[model samples]
Target: MRLRPPDRFGSLVTLRLLFCHGAVDFNVGVTTGGGGMTGFSTSDLALLLYQAAQDKNRWPVLVAALQETANPFDDDAIYRNPAARRELLDQLLPHISQALDMADRFESQAVSQNLLDRTLEMLPMGVALLDDELNIIMLNQQADRTLAEHEMLANHDGHFKINNREQHKLLHHYIERSLEDGSSHALMLSPGNPRSVSLLVCPADLVKDRDDNDPPAVTLFLSNPDFQSLIDEQTLTDLYRLSAAEAELTRDLIHGYDLRSIAQRRQVSELTVRTQLKSIFRKTETARQAELVSLVLSGLAPLRGRESVTAKVADDIGESTGLRYCKGAHGQRLCFAEYGDPQGVAVMFCHSVRGSRLEVPGGDSVLRDMHIRLIIPERPGYGDSEALDERTVDDLAEDMRCLADHLELPQFHLLGYSLGGFLALHCAARLGDRISRLGLVSSLAPPGKEAGKPLKGMMRLAVALADKAPGLAETVLDHMARTILKNPRRHLGSSVDRKLLAEPDHQERYLLALRESCRQGSMGFVQDLQAVARTPLPEPSSLALPVYLWHGEQDGQVPADQAIQLDRWLTNSELTLLPDGGHFFIYSRWPQILANFVAE
Candidate 1:
């Protein structure tokens, strides 16, 4: 029999013939006869052939059909008639050829696109392609960083936007014109700044061998003067065999600093600076400063100095690296930080709302001296911890349970600060005898009419929104998180906290922690607010363990009255009021509080 083209009608007719013939032969159950095979039935072979035709990759199915009987194609004689076997092969070969051709095409396209994306990522300046609607069709890694760092340029939901209205209008007008005429345009944003933001927009059609159907209309180039790919000084010294001072001078020149300015900054004579510069030239094999800087930038310097602070267990923990994570229930990441001695008394500390594991203020020395192992867990959606949607205070308790089990602590002291107190109480109640003691520091009470009375400023507003309008609360918290991430020192903490962070070392530590807290963005904080608003917090009376309440007399976020209320509700509880301490009393009074936690 001759084969026909695999058109819809032809395929249907062929399928119908195979089905009918296979059914007739299968019903007869004949072996070594003219109508049927010896081992593999005709009906089974027909069904396999049908499936292979419908499938995308036909070779595997064809192979399986052949393997249905041992030596079906040879001595076993699964096919009693040569005509039948010959007919099936004629039908299957076309589809197998088509599938092979398609696979080749897909692999080629994927390889080409991957190469393009990687090449774009290597460029120092930000690059983006835009359609006529100003929607971002594609943006490279540098462009993503640029959008994050600059307040002016934004890529909102794939739409490119400029925050400043007048600048937006001007840039839009130019972009539209460029799209129409296939022209190029340039604009300077924040021109008054010493290092201004430069934007260059050109028509995409100018590029050679452009796609014909619905191609990108505009190409945008972004250059921020503040943006620099910093090469590590160690890397420089290792690569060029330069001394520490020579590496410093090389870095300065690469960043566009002149010899005289470097001399003034180093408090050395211009002659000494020139001598160092000559040495750098000799080491780098460069004739001039410009050549040296260009050579450095053109090499691996542009890709260096990028550091990631996210860490895991058993890794060498750096002083600046506070994010240590572990797998929690459902394999979600639960990040926390350890303070005090590694072998000290274990106290699982719950961080407050809008707080990270790094909020323990007095440094690790105080905890070490007090012999307390402070295990501060970033609640769901906070810091480096994975966000759990629709989470509750009870869910946070479960996370604590997972963390404790992960650390192999059968029983440990528990403490909570601010909103964390609610989570601590929940854990204490749920974990039963596992919790040795419970401590609340400037903690909030169960939800009530007067629950939010003591709250002020953004905190008060957030609670109100969480109660009445959760979506708005998330938006507000997201904005606040971005602001905090942008400038932690300016946006995080109160005036008093800022004063405490006045020392550069203190400021750096605080800022780094704050950044890590918002690293996963505002979802963690939003989850906290939603949990607070909806979940019924555990009452103080439910927990049988000894409760310790430490409240600031001037506490503003959660009132001192709440601590008094908690003290009265608990059957066995001790309450302490700090006359001078406020919401942040944990920082100053942590040593004493930690000592009390481990004490009998």
Candidate 2:
């Protein structure tokens, strides 16, 4: 019998009649009487059809159907009998499985390539795909822009070369070495240009690129150092702790402006400009003008929103209470109280170990007379300030720099009282040129076993607790604060006799300052105690600024010996030994301190 004509796809409907007749005949052991090959039986008959097609017998219909197995359903494989359809599907199963695997692999590669292209497009740095010959086989958007900006990475007729002959030769050597050893390497290239870039060459074997039979040998990654990518104002402020005026000068100097031009633009005298540059140099820790510019272009710090000490003084300070804030590193808050004239010459007041900003009353007439913008910074973990577990004298000095920068003061006078004297020296050493002059009032010296023996008994106890068990120190100070609040005269002790606390106003102010110091706990007091114990402070003799050491001859907290030693150490210094003053002399003698610092 003749089968129906094949469709264009060479497909056929299910031939159930053939399977019904043949399977039944084979299973039941039935055959035609002629005993010819009239009835089909077993898989032996299906195998013969496959062999006939492989041997190129005249079986076009069966061969074509095998070739179309991938699209069998789409080819409309119409069969008249269900038995014939099931038999044909079983015979074509092996060919259909192979076709499915081929399609899956094709789709996977297409998706992978698309994702790679998109990712490369979004990169901020330049990237180049290089071949064995060091020619750029591929590059991304940033790479193209970089090449256009700087002729260092030049392209000629679709090949890339470093413009500098020396750098070019170096690039060749590195690329060849990477391919030879199948390793990765990195190098920085200056190309004798204003800026530089880092070139990272990784072996092709390391990257995930399956489609490249002869993969590119090396990949070069480049950083973009465009001329217009200068550090912003806020970045400068946060990074170097520079004031608005200082940061502006830094920007001008970085862009190659001379002192005269900067003065012309800012409408100030050249002397003012020179002073501002010196302040910028001190803050950024660069000694030369060229170095300052280089750092701004290449090594500026990331902005962290660290405003200068003056930024929020007017806004955050309560007009009635004189309370303010200064932000520290890592989102820490520094509590300070502002007193005196807002626009007056800036003078910082660092409190004694047992005192807060209120050590001097907020609205004192003496401070206003000197026209001083009095800034009293609470040390870490003091007053309403947050506690820092890791604090160093140098770190505290850096915080003071941030405070000065915020206040927009390029130069200021510095005063450290008691333990604060140790920290005052720290800042003076770091920023000697910026300080007009330095003054220490009964400041504690680094402990010399014999010299430190005369320190107050109560202070010694506080130091022991802070050094051995800080948690306990906090508790003790808290209790002490409460006691002082209950009865100020009793807690006055030897630091200040009951005579000072006789008036209600004097008692009230003294108690208020104590409350601020101990309100947050004893962390600040303990940190100060621990800092004084730090050894090998920078030499007072080495400082560039003048230092004044004042001590009470009758003092017990810090004896007269400390001032004598400081006098011997400082190159530009004077030791003023008071005849009958005590450790608390600063509260009474600040007017004199302010007058001396304000004097030329």
- Model 2 Cα lDDT, one tens digit per residue, 22-136: 2111121123345533223334444534443333231223222222221112222222244544555555444433332443454367569767756665454677888867777
Q: How do all models score by TM-score?
A: 0.50, 0.44
lDDT of 1 by residue, 362-384 (tens): 67667777777888888767776
Show model 2 residue runs off by greater than 4 Å.
1-321, 449-456, 492-496
Worst 10 residues of 1 by lDDT: 21-30
Q: For model 1, what is the alpha-carbon lDDT of residue 179?
A: 70
Give residue 9's error in model 2 in angstroms. 89
Q: In candidate 2, how many clashes are counted?
A: 12
Q: Distance from true position, residue 147, model 2, in Å?
A: 92
lDDT of 1: 0.66
